[model samples]
Target: MRVGSTMLVRQNLTRKLSRSILLVICIGIAFFVFGVLSSFRAGFEGSEANSERLVVASKIGGNETLPLRYFQQLGGMDEIAEVTHVTRLRAHTAGNERNIIGANAVDAQSYASVYADTYDFNAEIMQAFQADRTATLVGRQLAEREGWAVGDRVNLTSFVHMTQDASRDWSFVIAGLLDGAEPTVDTNFLIVRYDYFNAALLRNQDQVNLFGIKPAVGTDINVLAETIDMTFANSTAQTRTQSETAFMSAFLEQFADVALIVKLIVSVSFGTILLIVANTMIFAIRERTLEIGVLKVLGFSGSSIMRIILTETLVLFAAGLALGFALTAAVIPVLGDALSSVVPDLYLTPKVVATSVGLAVVFAVLTGFLPAIKALRLPVATALNHR
Candidate 1:
């Protein structure tokens, strides 16, 4: 019975090639957009999955700078495993004023120890960085995008903190390329030696932009965070400490309401798919009214007729969805370089693909339900009496 129904659907589609192709195209586009958008949202949220790390920043706000001495205090706690400081330096590459890079001065050893899983740091690279005061480690994606390599000199012009002469004084040699082990460690960042930046701005000795902290095993992160904050309560630079996940979430919140935006986009995309499939089903049922009546007259039960129609709709939607997902999976990796800066770690994981396909199937089933019911309810006698 199922085989017959499948054959019937194929015949119907083959007979009306243009309409079938149009339907497939519409469904394919909707699925493609759905898959891409869903993956992007997932990527955004996945940026903060590290369990053992935390970030300490100025209590005033995200942009406020914290004191470098705060790290020394945090490091003194038995509950704290390690502490590293980072300072944001918004700068452009040398000679090319148009080319911009998001660079940060970081304590490399501490950073590597904390995020060893996300960053593959070798002994040679660490030794080179430690030995050369002017050395910098660039993200793999950034290096590829900018055509940089080891031993290459790149000067950065600071936008936030400029020199009195209006000349960019910051420069570093690319010692190694840093590749993120996961999607969360933003691949567009350049990690330079924090000591270099500190030495350069000795007059501004107290300022450190952010501190990355790793908690000791079995320590309660919340309790330790509170303890660190209380220790700095009377300080000139107040502190705010949170888990690494919360740190990334805080940054994301500054841009937009991520949850609301993701919900809106998914809702709109699903609605568009519903309308497209529903409209296509309506037209298909209208055109096949006489055929449906013939089947009804030939002893096809209402339930059987409904099943056939639903099956056809499922086949069409499935084909389109499969095509779109395959295309997305193939294209996303190839365009990694172009999209890395904008949608860092944009790749179609298995979970993302499965969820997208499931969404398409659900929408297809819902949209086809009405048309299937309409076909099933057609009276044999009445349909036969019509032209």
Candidate 2:
């Protein structure tokens, strides 16, 4: 019975080659969009899965700075594993804002120790940073984009705080380059010694932008964050502390309502595919009314007739989905640089692939149902008597 049903579906599909090809193309395009957008949403959240760190920033927005002394006090806490200070210089390359990269000043030893796994810290790189105060370590992505190498000198023009002389005067020698082992590590930052930046901004002693803290094993992060805030409650520099995941999530929230946006996009994309498939199925059924009646008259049950139509729809959708996934894989690599900065962690996971294919099948079955039922309800004598 199944064999006869399969043969019938193939004949109908071949009879209308143009319609079959068009529907397959539509399904493929829809699935491609689904694969890429879903990957982006997942990539954004994936960055927050690391369990060991926290970010301490100002409660109020803007260029509010914390006193450097807080770093010492925070490091002394029992629940804290280590603390590192990060100040965003907000500087650009020689007054070119287009060359905007993260310019951070941090303690070399502490920073390296805390993020050893993320950043490839070798003795040679460490030695260069230690020996020279004017040296900086850049991320691999930034280096490749700007065509920089070791021993190259890069000059940055300060944007946040300008010198009295109006001279944009800060420069660093490229001592090393670092790459993240995982996608979460934000490999677009530049690291320099805090003392170098602090010494240069001695007059503006109160300005330190952010603090990165590592929590001790088994410590409650929520409790520790509250404690850190309370410790500096009376001080002039008020602080807000959160786990690394929460910290990164807060920053992403500033861009857009990510969850809502992703939901809306997915809903709309699938809804479009549903309508397309339904319309196609309706047309297919209209064209095949005579054929369906002949099959029923030949002793095929309603269930078998339904199965044949559903199988045709499923096959068409599957072909399109496979083609779309292949196209996505081939295209993403060519846009590597553009995507690296925008969607740093974007990649097609096995789960995403499975979900996309599953959605295609589910939607095809759902949209094809009404047409299948309509064909199943046709009387053999009436269907055969029709033109």
Candidate 3:
């Protein structure tokens, strides 16, 4: 009996090929949006869970530099395990659409240790980074994009120049490539020795964009962050300190509420999809009124008719989800390198796929439900005579 009902469902679907295809396209696009948005939100969320890391920056904003003296003041504190500072510099490569990333002038010896969780630097690379003032360590993504290798010389344009007429161009040899510990690390930037940058940029001397601190184990990170911020509150350059993850979150927030925006988009897409699929199902049920009446006359129960309709809707949803997932997979390899900064480790995880499929099933049931019930409630005699 179930096999016979399944055959009827398949026949009905084959008769309405265009409508099924449209419904599949709608659901697939919705799932595609959901998958991409969820991936980006995951990156921001995971960064917040690391316990020992904190970022100290100016109270004014990220662009405002803190006095270099705070580096020593924070380093001397008993609660801190390690402290490192970085100054931001604008960097440009030769390509027209080059993803111009913000480079960092870091204290070479200790910078690697600050982000030990996200990057691994070798002894030779660290030594070279420290010894040569002209040495720059490039991230793997940037290196691949620019086709740069160790010992390769490249010229970069820095926007921070003392004089308007002075040259913005600075040259450096690629000392090493940064090995990213995770995908979320914004490895699209270059790292130059702070001392080199300080001497070179005349006006921005003795200042850093932010400081990274590692607290001692067992210390209350919240309390420590508050203490650091308070200590510098009365100073010439006041500080605002927070967990490293919070800092990244705030940094991303400056652009916009990306997750919320994505959620809103997905919501709207799904809402419209619900209407379209429900309408399609209603029209399909009406067209098969006579067929449904015949089925009832043949001793098939009303519940069986409902199940057949629900199954057909679910099949359409499943087909759409499959196509959507395939599209996502194809686009990732092309866009992954560019979007790695925002949506790190973008791929079709089992969790995302399952969530998408589950959402589709729920949508299908909802869309098919009323129509199924209506089909069942129809009087066999009336339905057969009318159509």
Q: Using Cα atoms with residue i matched to residue i, what is each candidate's TM-score against the true structure?
A: 0.85, 0.84, 0.83
The Cα error of candidate 1 at residue 383, in Å, is 4.4
1 versus 2: better TM-score goes to:
1
lDDT of 2: 0.79
Compared with the true structure, what per-residue lDDT tens digits does model 2 show for residues 19-138? 889888888888777777777766665553455677888887426788888888888999988788888888778867776667888888888867775678888889998899999998
Instruction: Sort all candidates by lDDT, best to worst.
Output: 3, 2, 1
On residues 34-102, what C-alpha lDDT tens digit does candidate 3 reach at each position? 776665565544442354699999999987999999999999998998899998876665343255655
lDDT of each: 0.78, 0.79, 0.81
Model 1 over residues 304-373: C-alpha lDDT tens digits?
Answer: 8888878888888888898878777777776655666556667776787788778777887898899988
Off by over 4 Å in 2: 1-5, 39-52, 163-166, 183-186, 220-238, 258-262, 339-351, 373-386
What shift in Å separates residue 36 of candidate 3 from its native position after superposition? 4.8
The numbered model that scores best in lDDT is 3
